[model samples]
Target: MGLAKQQEQKILYISPLSLGDVEFQERNLGLPVRAVNQEEFIERVFGHFKGHLCVFLKRADGTPSNTFYKHSEKERMYKYLQTTFGINTYVSYSTFYQKVKKHKSDILRTQSNIVHTYMLVQDLDYYKFGMTDAECLQKIGQMVAKGELICPTFIVSTGQGYQLIWLLEPFKNIAGYTNDLDWRRIQDHMYEQLKELNSDSVVKNPSAVTRLPGSRHNKTKNLVYGFLANEVTFTLQDFLWFYDIVPVADRSVKPKKLNKKKATVTTIVKNWNEYTLNKQREEDIFIFVNVQNERGKSYIGIRNWLALVLRFHALVSSDNDTEYAEKRVKELCEIMDMSETDEEEILRRSLPAETYYKQWIEDTWDRNKYLRGGLFYTNSRMLELMDAKEDYYIQWKMKTIKIKNAKYEAARKRFEKYGEEEADKHTWEAFQERRNEKLASDKADKLWQLEEALDRHPEWTNKQLMEHLGWSLRTIQNYKKKLHK
Candidate 1:
């Protein structure tokens, strides 16, 4: 019983902040406030943001190095905040870990890992400055009150120190790189401004994770808590008022055109043995293959995605000299566990190697058409089409695709209950279903017209089909194939 009492005391010591404490603080701090509790704090701060919100937890029983790390959508991370409240908790101020494992020790918490940053934080260790927590808080309040400092969005009292957070509209990385120069410049300026208060300049990077509010500071034996000091979310320009830095958001930087000549199916296949893929291209292929192999389910969209990947690969791989990619796709039908209809559908949807080569060049080489395909399959759209699971994305370097898929599934399920809610009837899925049905009807009508035209002129060339039906070369050819079969 004595041992049990000690264990109970330890648990309470770790998580001493109760709901009553939250209420008492809220009542005492008479202000137009927010974040009465930890959950409320998380929701108010990060509920709207997408991408990975990392949580770091260090337990009393564990060594300093034995910290727990988790990354998930901000909505999902709310649960983590509750589950890890007893431990010493910290959270990435910006959502980092773009393309990595859901949970791994090697998970990136570097500046490069920061996909988007929504806040700038200043760590004020009052003890280092020989000040009390109340004195530090009163000082910050006085600074804001006197217009010496802009009001922080929230001020977290970290038991011994304070963290002042200035929430901003998302400052996303440009072209996969953080706006390092401008970001750092702002950080430096902010630090300089608050250096009198002993603001730690070291924690100014985009990767910095702030100690979570409403968690126990094991050494200090005090509860960490925060309250909203300001409601307005600042933009990048707002900070520029204090810091004399140019706004990185307004830069009209175009992607640099590579010096290499445009790749053609003929040229690539002719020099297939000598041709080599760059690191980016190789990585793309590797990720695609890994995603397919791990999922092990060849849905229609999944198979078409496979065909698309192979179409690019075929331009550099040797086979039957011509149309090798298509042939290879056919040979793999049995291996892929695809039905005859599935194979035929995949083939029908698959564009030629030349077309794929053209699109690839446009995506990689042409600045205006960078990463744009005919279907405009954005990362999230492609993931949804593949019916990707949360685990499949770890190796693919994708961020927020799992969260997006979840949202899409939720929207779809909501759409299914159309009669229950008026809003559900107008969902994107419902609209897409309607659009697809109309498209199918239109295609059937067009096919009937083409069949009639073909019956009248049985020996009609593809040129004749184009002239008669007013269709493109590829469309007429596809219709011709359909008519013949």
Candidate 2:
């Protein structure tokens, strides 16, 4: 689904009680190393959320256990956790409750079972990288001052590391709503934005738990406490700006120069362009490489290989919709002429290894996996893998394979007309050089268009420019900085 463009930030209407007593008490608070007790911190962070809450705690027998309780029973839950010394506690941000399903009461916490997520979390563990707490805090301060990072609503000190919380107006997680995808995009963007802060990548899952504020750190024996940064709360749209941004290709966001003692934080962005293929591209490649009509010479063991490919795509494309995914996988298997036995085998394999499958899918994030550090196979390598004939290229829909074929045709024509010397200009290296030149030209044209729009409407506000030119507020600010300078 296409994400809605964010032209401006929108603040939710926060009630006085929703602001909590922590914000009231800390009206004059600064970003100092202050901490609050268990009760106050928990209420301030989770008071707005409704229904049953899920938490992980250490039992008296030293076994780790997770439990769900009604919001009114929170006091009892807290008592249970506090009874055990050095007991670590963790909490999930997704709001859930007990429901009667199939004549049994169950505590549901799956992605679909969640009503809404009241906050997004960033697990910042600087100590893992040998940085002290004070050093990490100072770097965060510098980043905020330079407008390089968004100030989190609150910060939790987990004895060894920190958890940054961005409270949001409860965003619905229903199937029909677009919030689920937008929420994922926003969370992923935040992870990328704060990678320099050693943000934990795996904590972005909706039902994933992190250290609970006011809980004890098992190893350090220090109490985990939270402090107020501000009373700021956001709606889903407030974070729309980040979702619409595309990371600059093969380039790092260089901060302004500073001396040794005051160096700016260097942002080394992963050029996703070089590392990952989009969902459409991956699906097209899978079909072109594996699908066959009659299954003759390539028919030997092709059924097993096709089943694996289909299962992989189902896991990635289903968006946690298990029932739909199951049905879709069966339909696809049938279309590919796989027997019912093959279909059942694929589902059986998938059921036992959902977690491991997710890990395998993420392995594409590894920069050293494929050609030029891409997550998927290159067109030439794909062709090599399938032993594809020239006919396969003619039937392909995605541009990657078609572009490869075009280059081959171009080179053949050039060599026929003007010998090997002129054909050298159409080689891969020369092709890349020409592509880079075109990209640069397009960037210049965009900047020129922005400048021209500003000249025609000198009195226009940022909002007006956004509405007129269809650029994000951040994009407009960036262009203004460059054009004025």
Candidate 3:
């Protein structure tokens, strides 16, 4: 647990939909030296007792540790018990092993047998509850026997009081949740109901951790064990008793006014863009990193996202034949500081798409805002699939071409109608005349080179020069004619 806390609660990090289950798993920790899978560990803990189980431990310092350590077959943890000022002291910083077991998100999402509610019994509050710890356990056993309240699957007698855990049945329908917002709704409803009954004390958040069975309480120094029955199971429907426990709708005296204290913590920033990609979002194959019209903002996280987008584009858009994809890829390669050859190999490699492509897209969308409509196409789903459906690509393409000469308008129209190849070829001259465009400098440089070559190699004919320069004879002849004029 300490290690997990250090890594921003890595073990506890779960899909919002799974938060309820994560909290439940936190509470029902296995009171043993070694941790095992959820089911086996639950079985071992609820099974018949063998020896003293170490539930909690503390270092020389008084700091509390959220973990339980040690399991042995002999000398029930009594050896660790100590008399402190006439009172037995066993553990301070004590915790049991807890693991969600399903490390992969996909597998864990499918699991439904999440603990819905947890019950905590303590001796410290017997005065308020008006029942001794033993009396409370007896009443609980009676309730179970009569089927009024569901029997707790596992019950532990902590030195201070008693801890009872009731497990809910598996709920298979866990997907398609709306922001994982409703998993704890039942817990809240139950809490309100308990408040009406004035026994809200028993209700604890599903994330709450109880004292590991077989461990001694730190202050009480008494051993903990299963109270009544060793094993049990109940349906989620069984929890309806909490509603009946209070039954607030009645003609009665006025309810007491409850005072509330609220604490506010301000956060400088928050990312509300967390999303799980559906099949459509998953198939969005290309992410074009474009500079927005506004000032460019840079961050290390966005830079890494840019690299990820480029890599995915090369992987999925590799088969696309459009000049649009090719041109965009070239620009992206330059921005990435990778050579065209490296880009080609990345495109040609017969490898699977990134395993975390969906995650990358979600993360990238949140971090960067330079994404433009040029990345997405306006028409043709097939073209969208071919070009990654970025909203900025066509918008950018339109904006860029219009800034050039009017002659390029027809080609832009042709691009919308006849696609990249015909459009680019038709717009070639206009593009060449526009200083802002790539073709203009390219044509100028070619003409300069031809003029230099004619002076240096006067003996070479136009055909030989054409062969060397990979230019058409017609183009060379035109250049020479222009030179003479």
lDDT by residue for model 3 over 1-485, one digit each (tens)?
22222122011111112221122222332111122332243344333322212223443356533222234422333343322212222221112233233454422111132222223222223325665654554555444344333334444455655544554443322222211122233445534433322343433333334554444555656655443332334433223222221111111111122212222322111211111111112123222233322214222112222333334333333322234334544555454333223656433331222422333334432222112211211223222222223333343353211122343445457667767655555455655656466666776788788988988998999888998888998999887886777
- Per the 3 Å backbone cut-off, how many clashing residue pairs does candidate 3 have? 18
Q: In model 1, which runs have C-alpha deviations exceeding 4 angstroms?
A: 1-32, 60-80, 98-107, 174-178, 246-485
Off by over 4 Å in 3: 1-62, 67-124, 127-130, 145-147, 169-203, 228-230, 235-485
In candidate 1, how many Å is residue 231 off?
Answer: 0.4
Please tell me which model should have the higher lDDT, number 2 or number 3.
Answer: 2
Q: Per-residue lDDT tens digits of candidate 2, residues 34-107?
A: 35566765676678567667777765568966677777788787777677447788887777755334444543
The prediction achieving the highest TM-score against the true structure is 2
lDDT of each: 0.56, 0.57, 0.36
User: Is candidate 1 or 3 superior in TM-score?
Assistant: 1
Worst 10 residues of 1 by lDDT: 6-15
Clashes of each: 2, 0, 18
- Best candidate, lDDT: 2
